[model samples]
Target: MTLQKKVIWITGASSGIGEALAYEFNKKGAHLILSARRIEELERVKENCSDSEESVKILPLDLAETHGMNDKVLEALAYFGHVDMLINNGGISQRSYAVDTQMSTVRRVMEVNFFGTVALTKALLPTFIEQKSGHVVVISSVMGKFGTKFRSTYAASKHALHGYFDSLRQEVYDHNIDVTLVCPGYIKTDVTINALTGSGEKYNKMSKGHKNAMPPDEFAKKLIPKLAARKEEIYLGGAELMGVYLKRFVPKLFNKILKRVSVT
Candidate 1:
């Protein structure tokens, strides 16, 4: 279906890629459900949409509040009566070495990035089944495809999404439910500063490479069309995207390069 008439619900919509997606989809005439923990920020995104008067609903939510996901999702269903698509984009990043990271931090990352995403997807599955049509767009990362230093838990969580969503795609293919996993590299966003370190503190610092990364708006512009067409797996970013293959055919080379990569 054309995005012009689609109803999309986006998480992590307060800023970055999610906010950009909200704007891009609005330009295409889609009804949007913009969600994030920051209500004011979500409202700002809605205001920035192509048509502010149009049907753009703001639902502030925290993915980390895993227990309340079902209720929030049900409330979302009530917003439009049916959700045409769910963009499972709310997630955290890792900024510490695996050994140095705390178990609590790892679990928290998994909860927000993997389990919480799955929970929301499961809650919405019955709705898709009843209609026999829907799309699930997951914003994964190149790190999801291949592991790197100081980001073990983040990589694992993203990798888990790939496995789960890929399987779900096949299971529901016959029912017209499509799943698209977006693997983005270093598109500029606050993901780095907000990432959790080994001690579970916010990194609060930008990586040197991130300052020169792709703009979120441009990334979203490229992504919206792909989602509309329902591509199963799409990769974004520059050399980062190439890392996927570097890990496959040249493991040693990949390890050598990653060893110099720093999250600090």
Candidate 2:
């Protein structure tokens, strides 16, 4: 469907895939509410977009601050009176082995990635139900589809999103609300650099796979069409997407491959 005049709220719009989505959606004449913890960066993203002064609204938000979710939703709705779509893209990653990871570290990741995202979505659900029309997009990872080394908490967080949104999709179907889970494989972003370590420190290193992954712009370009289609779920990536199918149809072989995979 055409997104002209569509009002979309995108979290994590300060960088990476979220930044790219902001530009692409703006090009389609969609009004945007750009959110992230960094207000300056959100302003930078807004300024860089076409017709952004009127088309984009910068709203600073920290995903971990779940208690303030209702206020944020109110502010977002105040920006445009209504929201046609909400993109939950702000999340953290893990780069350390689970055994070495502290419980606090795991809790932090879950707080930001899973609980925070769901909180925002829940906060906005009432509006959609009232309107009887809306779309929700969650930018999950291929890691959500299957487990791998050194990213246990991260994977669990993503997996929880898949389960939650899947059930939400079904429940909201009658309300005409679409829930889409986008499983992205390696995209060349700073995810690895900012990933959490065992002790909750930034990993500060790029991985071999990310070194040769798709660019954020291309990924966003490919994503809009899928979003317009209102797909229940879509996996975006190169060969890494094959793992989703392998895990589904060949569990034994998938497990063997996972042990040897270069997840770093």
Candidate 3:
């Protein structure tokens, strides 16, 4: 149940929450596989790990590319024979209204955030079931639970994840596989700056809320124990967590409040 000695694979490990989690998990003595599009950044993260030479590994992957992911799963298994956990953290965000967004742009975001994540998980499912032990950790956003302005595609992708994984969780429960659906609020990441616009270009600007949002490192610190406990669904953030409740209990009021809140 502890992270120590467990083989944990984290996608999007080059920066932000993924990078911070790499450091935190290394400190906890987990054998790590860090994957991302950038090899150099993965190398940098590995270099920073505790006893990294003996425990950490780097596997470059692009979530948007699914043809090679089954092979990537094999390659990941080759590292430690089996993976105890797969952190489905790799994804893209959008920052445009539906009316202004391109269909191609929306598909691209969905391809990365939903299809890519599902491809990897479905690829890894047999291994987990065979071993009778594994964890699927998804780093969804608060937008998954509730929609916001300028996040049409982003919210859709996240909502899709909740539906898919919630079903997957039930199906896998008997196989001793667990799923953790994490809805993270505004963590101080480059997500906003890296978010896609209507034309599929980067937004390149930080949101006002993200200016004082939770730090990724601090978030990583809080998340490890919850994962160890096998919590089914978790919402991690500050005041923004309230939106999840508001939307659920007082839909009319939440929609009115959502309009006034500046998401960008």
Candidate 4:
């Protein structure tokens, strides 16, 4: 269960939670495959690791390009010849209303957030089955459990992840492959800044909620323990955690509260 000596491959490693996880796992003496679309940023993150040159390998990847994911998985395995864990963290966000959002934008969001992650996981399944031991960690969101204003498509994409991975968990349990779904609430990251607008343009602005959210490093520190414990699902955040429980136990009340919640 310990991350020590484990070969962990992390997507979206260039910044935010993914970058923090790389540092945390590096501290635990885990060999890391850091991947993101920006190779330069990935290298920068790798350089900051404890033993950058020895323990980290930067693999530039664009999760939206699902067609190339199998090849990318091959390249990832080439580094250590095997991988103990795969973290699906690369995804986009939305900052527009459902009615105004373009269909192309919805497809793009789903492509990167849902399809891309699914494709990569499928590519790596054979290896996990062969090894008879591997872990899959998905970085989903609180929105996956419930919809909120300005996040219809983004929430849908996350909801799809929950459905897909939940099923995959059951199917892979006998294979000794564990699946963990991490639903992180508001965290201080560039997700809002990079979120797509109705017209498919970057929002390019950070929200007050995001500005005051938990730091990515702090969130990562708390998450590693849960991951090591092989928890099926864990929610990391402040009061937002309550929404998941409320939705399950008090659907009517939760729906009323959701309407008044300022998710932006």
Candidate 5:
């Protein structure tokens, strides 16, 4: 879909990839609804956009607030008459070993990353159906494609996005509702630092790997166009993008490599 004048809602727009996406789309002439828990951060991003007041709206939301999602989405949707694309990008990350992780941590991760995304998508489905044309872009992870150390819960949450969206794609293919699942490797983001440890607490420290990853703006620039074309699935990263192939064609080698890689 052409982004020009399109109305897009991007969750997790307070920073990182989502924030970069908001700017990129703004530059491409898309009207945006930026959301996250930090209203000030959202405002900062909005200010940076050209025609900030006219082109963008900020709606602060906590995706993990399960009970208020319906109301939150209603309020967010009030900004645009119709949402052309809903970017399900708001989510938390896990930072503990799976075996050591508490059930609460797993549930919280699933709640924010999986259920929250699915709920928001469901809430907007009727609007898309009415329009008969819409796009759902999910920002998953390269880890979604494979299991990694200290990230079993996180991997599971992202992997669930693939399963849910892939199924929804087939179900809605006839309705002109396009779904794009983005599996990105590390991009410069606070996702890792904010990732949850075993006891359901934030790690609050950036991982060395994340600090050295690709810049979010560059990653967003590379990704947004593919999304515009309604690609089914796209992977963005460096050598880690190759893991998709390795996991499928060389499980033994992939396992070996994964063993050597550091997740935290």
Candidate 6:
């Protein structure tokens, strides 16, 4: 379905893919509810949109705080009286080995990346059910489908999203609710820089692969059309896309390849 005039709520709107998507959806004439922890940054993103004042609304949200999500959802719904789409894009990444990573760090990752998204989706479900039509788009990762070095906890969080959303899709099928899981491989963004190290400190450095990855705007441009087509899942990236296929079709080889790749 077209995004024209649709009230689309996007998390992580301060930067990266979420920020780029705001511009793309704005170009499609969609009314936007831009959300992130940084209200000032969210406003900056909104101001950059085509018709900032009329089409965009900033809703600062901290996804890690699950207790407040229901209230956030209610406030979001009040924006346009209904939300046509909800983009589950708010999450954190990891850049540490499982052996060295602390349990608290792992829990923080899961809390923000998995439970937070689930909580918000649950809060919005009643509205979508009443409306009888809504799209739930999740920005998962290639790691969700397979294990990789230095991303054990982060990968686990994403994998959890796949399992939960896959089940939700089946349960909501008859309700006219659609779930699209977008597994993005490496894309040029601050994800790596902000990734948590084993000690839970920011990695603070971009990886070589991310430096050469697809630009977020370019990824967003390609994503919108697929989303409009209502695809259940789509992978967007460069050579990393091969890993998703290899893991499914040639597990042994994929395992070997993962071991040799200089993931960082």
Can you write out model 3's per-residue Cα lDDT over 42-147, one digit (the tens) per residue? Answer: 9999998889888998999999998788999999999989999999999989899899999999999999999999999999999999999999999998899989
Better by lDDT, candidate 6 or 2: 2
Write candidate 5's Cα lDDT for 62-177 as tens digits. 88876777777688668777789999999999888778899999999999999989988988888788889989999999888898888999999998999999999999988899
Assess the local accuracy of residue 134 in candidate 5 as a C-alpha lDDT between 0 and 100.
Answer: 89
lDDT of 3 at 174: 94
| Lowest summed lDDT window (length 10), candidate 6 | 46-55
lDDT tens string, model 1, 83-190? 899999888898987889999999999999999899888888888998999999999999888987788999999999999999999899888999999999898999
lDDT of 4 by residue, 70-139 (tens): 8988999899899999999999999999999999999999999999999999999999999999999999
lDDT by residue (18-62, candidate 2, tens digit) is 999999999999999999999989988988988877889998999
What is the lDDT for 262 in model 3? 77
Say which prediction, candidate 1 or candidate 4, comes out ahead on lDDT: 4
Error of 2 at 230 (Å): 0.5
The global Cα lDDT (0 to 1) of model 5 is 0.89
For residue 136, what is the lDDT in candidate 4?
99
Task: Write down the TM-score for model 5.
Answer: 0.96
Q: Which lDDT values do the candidates have, in the order given?
A: 0.88, 0.94, 0.93, 0.93, 0.89, 0.94
Best by lDDT: 2
The C-alpha local distance difference test score for the whole of candidate 2 amounts to 0.94
What TM-score does candidate 1 reach?
Answer: 0.96
The better candidate by lDDT, 1 or 2, is 2
- With a 3 Å backbone cut-off (N, CA, C), the pairs that clash in candidate 6 are none
Better of 3 and 5 by lDDT: 3
User: For model 6, what is the alpha-carbon lDDT of residue 122?
Assistant: 96
